[model samples]
Target: MTAADDSTFLNISLPTGTPKAERVAFLRLCTALATASLDPADAIDRNLWFAEAGLGDLYNKPTLAAAANTLIDLVEQGWTLSTAYKHGPLLAPPPSNADPVVEKARVRRQEHLRRDPQLRKASVRRFVEGMEKPREFKGKLVTVFNLMRDGRELADSLTTAPDPGSVIRPYIQIVDGSRCERTGYLLHDIWRYFRHTWSNAYSTVPGRSMPILIRDAATPHHAVIGLAAISSPVVQIAERDEWIGWGTDTFLEEVRKAPSDEIAAWLAGRIDAQLGEIYLEDLLADNVLQPTDLHHPTNEAIAMLRADAERHRQKHHRTPLSEVRQIEQDPWVQRATSHLFRSKRAAMLADTLEASRTLRPFFSPKPAADGLCQALSDTKAKVQLRRLIRRARGERVGTVIADLTVCGAVAPYNALAAGKLVGALAVSPKVIAAYRAKYSRPSDIASSMAGRPIERESRLSFISTTSLYGSGSSQYNRLRWPAAVMGGPNDKWISFTELGRSRSFGTSHFTDETVDALVRLSRVKGAVVRVNSVFGEGVSPRLRKVRLGLAALGWPSSELLKHGRERIVYGIKLVENLRDYSLGIDPAPEYLLDPEQADETSVGVWWFERWGQRRAVQPAVLESMRRHRLVRPISHGARVPLPTDETDTTPTESMFFSADSS
Candidate 1:
């Protein structure tokens, strides 16, 4: 329909009036009588055909006029076309009221059946399988695997000797049977057993057997697996050493005390134990005995002694090397020796650091008589000095600088450019002495620091820090809303730093860059309004409102949103920031990084299309939009851009360089 005079008319609500009984009857009669005398079988088509055939000749036909009069009478008597000209008292009295009650019960029963556990399980499976891309199922599979790993550990503990009728078989079956969609065959059996064990298994039962056990536990089946998979978390907290150690400490002690002949036998029996349990056994044995065989002991006592003796004999029989030059001749042996030395050093370092906290306060020495007088003025400085000294020795200088800047211990400029600040800090006498001693020598400070010659610059495409949004992340953007697009400048066109400290740009210079990116992204142009939080300490609630509002606007499916690779990456970053901020560890916000814009996807574009259609751009506006390829008419209305095929192989750069897209 043509729009009314006002632009507001384009937004009219759909009419909802229902026709009266008399009017409905009259229309039905006219339609039926016109169709070959209302033959019910050929009603619609024949009526139109007959109407065309007889309308011209109706003036000359008296009989036709009488038939028409009869039709008019039927209509006047309130006979619909389906009533066949009879207005008789209905043969069947107003449908038995019981029928409706019966129908309602039937409908309820059908609904119950549809949601029946076995049926719903099947449905859930089908639903998951039908998903073109299945991330939830993938996550669930990981959960299942983790559960299986834990179950395997527990299963090993359950059995001492192999049995044909082992519960391990059923246990493994149960684990494997747990599906991403529903509890599988064996798991369902286990679930049934669990339900029988617990009276409150299903919500339907109180003092009786739960009638809807399957239905009640049906939805939470995968959830149960999920809980089990991560169940190790609390267990780890409860028994950290036992949880992390491959074998039990007692089991390892037993292995260590065992005769060399028995070590292999013990290991053979204990390989199936938890990793922590086995690891302890090996470690204890290494501590007490010589480093005989680095690999595992043999499976049999007799075999183990022979292997041990042979290794020992061979070691004693080999020629010894005294010089470093001799050691370099055997590269494999040198590498192994180096690895051993490095590992031992690392362990020593870890132990030293753990103990250093206690030792860091003071060395066991009295200072000179003048020190006592000077120390009184420097107690607080001494404590700060001790911390700085320990940090200089134990932590990376760059990390210390960054933390100091973030915590406002030092200015950002002073931290990044560290010459004068380093001289002023007065951290460790040892660290300072080493630096001063080196720089005081007749050697270049830069050469000493690098200790190597520089190579030619690499020719590879070097992605700069500015070009990327996140560390070790992808470089794609997914904002597709017109408002989101227009809110920021396009990639090459806009520099967000020019906007100054816009709330949208956030506090950091990096945030301004992020704002620029969002502005440049093609989607930020059509936001109806920006809502700020009226309450709360942060903008989180307002951000949530935007999310839910867009969702109501028919946000695309999870799959569609997932398909926007760049958008998903940004969304992940946004969520990560939310988490980091909660933990007081916010990364400097980068350019074009509006949390809402960052989280927007191609799916969100679909939502804008849905909301935009209701408040349509007029013909003149639509035509203008067409020039920019923003909108296009389909059968009834304009259609949105659908996702493109991944394998199209059309060069992305080519498409990007093309004219303004709709």
Candidate 2:
């Protein structure tokens, strides 16, 4: 093939939103056309091509027409054998009189292609092979793989030995959901394993979810350690709200009162119209003059009426109604009435009267008849009103805290104290900075402060239960940062009681039973298993199959896989920030580089000297630490030992480890 044909075939770019069947058909057709010796001038016969590819029965006329048009467009763009072979590939055709900039770009691309012939050739070969043998679709059904039985040899090889001399360093990196590269595959596999072996509950990766992979960077082959998924900050948390001075009662009260307050303000204005009508009615009722007489009253009669009204007003405490009556009796007033007050008074009188009647029940400060205050107070009316309020406010109702949703290490790494490494990275300034930037919009910041949907700023990070509590493993507490450094009162290194009080208020697809099953599975297996979704319920079978395939070898199957759902609501506060908190940090000072460098020994010594001398640590800090059994009293300048005995022997491990450990 000509260089142009090679380039065109090698870099096939398909339009998005095309159906799978049509895409496959198009690929097959392209491969057939490229391999066959056809004349460039001959128009492609759609019917013959479809028949040759065994797709004649599958596509309809409209679909075939669309496909034909797409093919024609591609050929026009030099993405076909005719254009590639007849003329050079459009990407780098023989120089025509073109713009200097465009020509320079083309020449540069050609140079790169020439310099990397092997890479280009490999790419072309892969594309041709892929087009020639497209993947066949089987009807969606998940067949459990017996990894233990079928892949015993492979399984044994993977688990047979641990490299004692080879240190396992896990690096955590965030995956961009928009790109479907190797990182995407890593995320998919992690979720799959969690579903089949850890949690039978199906989990979904949310649009705002930051999916992270933990990989062993020490080995030549970067094997995955585990998966950590962090979703958008929660809108409401009871404990978090309490901490921020907005508890459940306060949040609900504010929501309920806002609408009522609005209605009250409207009613207050409305009451004034009723009062005006009442004043007008009293004047009209007490008038002594007949309507005809008032319309054509002489000046003498007007003077007499005025005199009488003055006398009545002097005798009574209130103003006499005859004062207004006398004005209506004047000839000039009658004439002006015809010009200005003829229909205006009548309309005003009617409106005020109607308002007075409608507001009669509320005059005594009772519940408003049809206003928001009335609806909020009445239990029956509150449901709809509450929904309206929530919708109007966009469901933000509490304080926001950056939640550390999932944190742990896989088998080998977990055994090697990799949990602390992953945990520290989870709260690293870089990761936190990315999250903050993601939600930096004005709307997001507003929502987060209000405890609503958008979460832009977070001063705290928390976890629900320690790995020790759920998985019978001490990796979380031992390896992770002590609660003191995270900005909590020393007395409460970790709040065990708060775990039960944390609440998740949102809709989730998984039924309570499914969630319970997943939790139970995690407890039984001694692993932290989280459910994103279920199986056949609302989830697509194709997606379920792909996720299931990512399970670890020797995964056991269960029958409770009927429901397919993504997104679960679990509430707990496992991590927190007590002091000045920020997300990304410039590379930490060279000495404090690695995540492990922030270990208890280095941190404790630093705190004792740096913060202690300045009295930055609270008076109760040391006491609280001692109370929590987090530290042992020692003389100044004494060395702090590692948390575990296994770690104590590895003095070199502590010194050399850095964030650049990867």
Candidate 3:
């Protein structure tokens, strides 16, 4: 950490116009910081705090450079920022009123106030006071609201309790959002409310979702013992992608040596003839396209695109992105896009197209292992067969591969580690069947673009989720079922595979108000806010808007977006070959669970034997369950108390500050 020994990290070049005195002072400060043990986010915050107090000048390029150098050094030494930090100073303003981050926060507050003025708040308060009389919960003898039976009748079960594993029958029921039956959407929303309320990080995004209710038949009225849901998987996840081998894997390896006519016809059929031209027009005109938009274009295609995009930027001298319908109708662009694919990759792509045909364009900081070798490595041959494979990976991201939005047991069941049981059922046959039924309908976006309902076979092949708190989820650790029982290969197992942690990059930490203010500020700064709230515009529009705003404020969006905490990611495969089945290369998925014999019932039996019985035998589990008697405070394990005198929702200031937020 000393200057003599740590010169590599401490070596920094100040700005051209930086005074000699300031450079010397900054280097001295940098030397002190280099030895200090601090996280990247903490260092940035402390530096900014000092700068605001006239102790440092972090605004200037020279000071920022020094700080960055120090940060890079700390990062190399195994220091990191928590990605879950919400009020990070990196993206937001410092405490100083003059700071841009502070100003943006002020603007966000102002905008929120302006949108819903104090007058409106006062009016609503007055109206509420005048309209309704204050009421309290009274002993309800006539109007009873509960899913459980009479307390007296239930209380006896604890004293003369039967073996929970033998009597308690657990089963999974698919919750359809549209159904009006008793065991339908209402229960799902109720479960979601409890789920989000208890877990600070749990959230549901736009797009596809499937809510499943786990019920215990032994309990009165088939009461909800646990809840789980499946939602659309994100298009890009670095750790998940690398594990799936999106780049090293090949999509058309067998067809590589096929006849030119045969290959051409197959490629032509795979191409979206209707949406291809229109999408390509949007791709060239606008910013760098989302890789999911293209169908794994070849090395030649990507090169042509970068060249064309650069040309458009220079010629237009303004906005390049166009999602408008007008461009789709452009005759010349239409003609150009029609031949763009065939002339570039489709024509030249064959067995002969080897490592020599390298991609000149840069996708990331480090080049991928896309057919590169040392034998002919003298040239700058950067082949990008990754895109084609990546495209295959993305095909099922929206449909076939669903992420668990919420998966865990409720109170009494959780006492016996029933959460593990829920995790086990996540990959059961019933879930797969339910997913197929829910998403088999025509895609609205695809249907509209093609002028007809496009019915594609959308079935669940994989189920994935991230740990809620830390580096891994305890409920899923060593959780597996014998593949032979589930009708899979005997050598393999149907278990959750560790897919590495996420890179901890997102805009979740930024409050809605912060994002709104940033978007407003971006507009004032003459920055084109591309997130138009339009469907199919992009994933996580709020995040996109926030990134643009951060950039407008002269900050690196990529760096600031990384708040630092990364959660462990896990994936469960229902099909034999997840990559191939997901890419539509395999016509029918080789599901792990048998169609006729193996089902949710089998899963229930396994859960009882696998985890439930073993847990119930533990003295701690029995003692915990004993406390959940009829008269005991409800939902204690979930950190929830009902609308009663015991319910303490009001915080006493100690929660927010060292003393009080006073």
Candidate 4:
């Protein structure tokens, strides 16, 4: 007490109860600062290291100025100095309440490298370094970049923190490109820095030297491993909002826009793939920070679980899920777990089925529920059938089939329709019976349809028997019809089911007419004729049923309704081999053929058939051809004869036949 009291009285040893470790750390930092104080050349590392120690709270006075002051103090204290000059005193003083000791340490450290020649040389060296030569891959970095951007936009358009996986899976193509991979590499570097700096505070091994989560040191391997280095471990453990909301579109766009190179393209693809994988994890997150219905059953189930968790949380602040389940019987949750493909049964069964040869990988694979898989298979079969019919009819399905099939993509129509049908079958016994009768084997049908008359005598029975409108409404849009009815592989095709209805239906009654039409059809028996309008302005109603003969079928007042008068145009040009001469004109094999050209409408039932087929094709050739055509028509052009330039020596064969056919 005597020594301490005397020291305190002399103000040499203030009232210091701070931990020994902290004091040691501070002294070490001071020593480092002192060592670099006189020389401005060593300041960057000196101050940067000090700041890294969590003294950012000090060295203010416009940072550089504070560093200059720190340098001056260290110099006065007779500390070793480097060959550099101090930058300057900070223009503004640090906060009045800031700790002077910390401030002094930071100021001193920062001043060490204020004018170091080596630092300048290092910076210049980096600028002068040459980058690796560019490479080429299957797809362009720009395209993938565009896809990411589009995917992000699509995801953000949804109400929830979109089903992260679905956000990228549908739009991003995993073709050969380095854009995504490079991005991953960049992310790796960034995280490496963070990890290295972080470890200094907590771990013995330097962060940079330590392996990332996956432990693979190989660059390509590291690039492929998505979870190796997330933004922050805390965010990951807490499931931070940023993690939930991590979309790489903006970052990817930059990658895409980078100079066209193989490395860039490949990296882009890798990054996209990684993003897609992360998205899937996010989709599987229990609590969807941004909830979206546009996700697969597994994702939806996860979101539902999250919602249930939130509900439980609201009810019993911070109660664990296990205990909360004991409090209430949750059927919605149970059913979701069972049918939504996240349940243990679904996972096991799906994995088995996927491994088996009986099921198609795209239509039926791991983690898919039996019912869902069957529905997906049926939808896929129907799509294949439609495509076959379309190809037979003459449609041009894009080359996205390989992508869609391998990735297990279901057309919006397929999802919507199958979902609608499945819902209906689950809820309506008649619909189930009808589907069984129509699709099941005869023996099975005979066993299942025992005793009941083949034909039922009610509208509900008929609809149930037909399996037209499924039981549950869509999760995305309740008022709108299921996408299945429209029958296309794209969202655009699905829109047909709604008759070009605007998305702003909830805002006005105009769309109510469309809903009314659907409702009328649902309620009315047999063929009913109802004239509906978009504006809800025209509604002519008449109650009448017409019978054609004594035992003839009958029709209700509703007409066989047609869609609105919107005409989509398609133009066709015909090319034919013109040859064989008889009498007069022996053309130089090619001539002006404008009159032989014809423009025709691309309408009718066969239009879809002509354009809805897919084939394995290289995109590079298609793109090149397109560009070539844009510059100059790939097909030959006709040469017109001019009276002035003609030598009047046109060859006229003795037995030339009529060659031009219009």
> All models: lDDT?
0.23, 0.35, 0.50, 0.23
The number of clashing residue pairs in each candidate reads: 41, 27, 12, 67
**For model 2, how does the per-residue alpha-carbon lDDT over 445-543 read when each residue is reduced to its tens digit?**
222122223333332243233221211234343333334553434544332233223212111222232223333333333332223232101223233
TM-score of 2: 0.30
The residue-by-residue lDDT of candidate 1 on 1-662, one tens digit each, is 11122212111111123124333433343444424243321113323433543433433432232223323322222223332223311111011123544433332332222122222243433432222111343334221111111222222322333431221110001122344344232444333322221111111211101011111111123222110000001111112222212123332333334324233322222212211111122223534222332222222322343344344333422323243224233333232233222232223222223222222222214223233223223555334323332322221111111110100001111111111112112111122222223223221111111222212111110000111111211111221222223132234211111101111111111111222222222123333323232211113332333343323323221211111111011111111122112111232322222222222222223322433222222344333222321112111111111113443222222111211111
Per-residue CA lDDT of candidate 3, range 188-236, in tens?
4445434532333334577788887787676534655677888888777
Measured on C-alpha atoms, candidate 2 has an lDDT of 0.35
Q: What ranking emerges by lDDT with the best candidate at the front?
A: 3, 2, 1, 4
Best by lDDT: 3
**Model 3 regions lying over 4 Å from their true place:** 1-163, 178-185, 248-269, 272-386, 484-492, 595-599, 628-635, 638-662
Model 4: ten consecutive residues of lowest lDDT: 398-407
lDDT of 4 at 154: 24
Model 1 spans with C-alpha error above 4 angstroms: 1-643, 646-662
Clashes of 4: 67
Q: What's model 2's lDDT at 367?
A: 35
lDDT by residue (tens digit), candidate 4, 581-618: 10001212221122211211111112112211111022
**TM-scores for all candidates?**
0.15, 0.30, 0.61, 0.15
Query: What residue runs in model 4 are displaced by over 4 Å at the alpha carbon?
Result: 1-135, 138-208, 211-662
lDDT head-to-head 3 vs 4, winner: 3
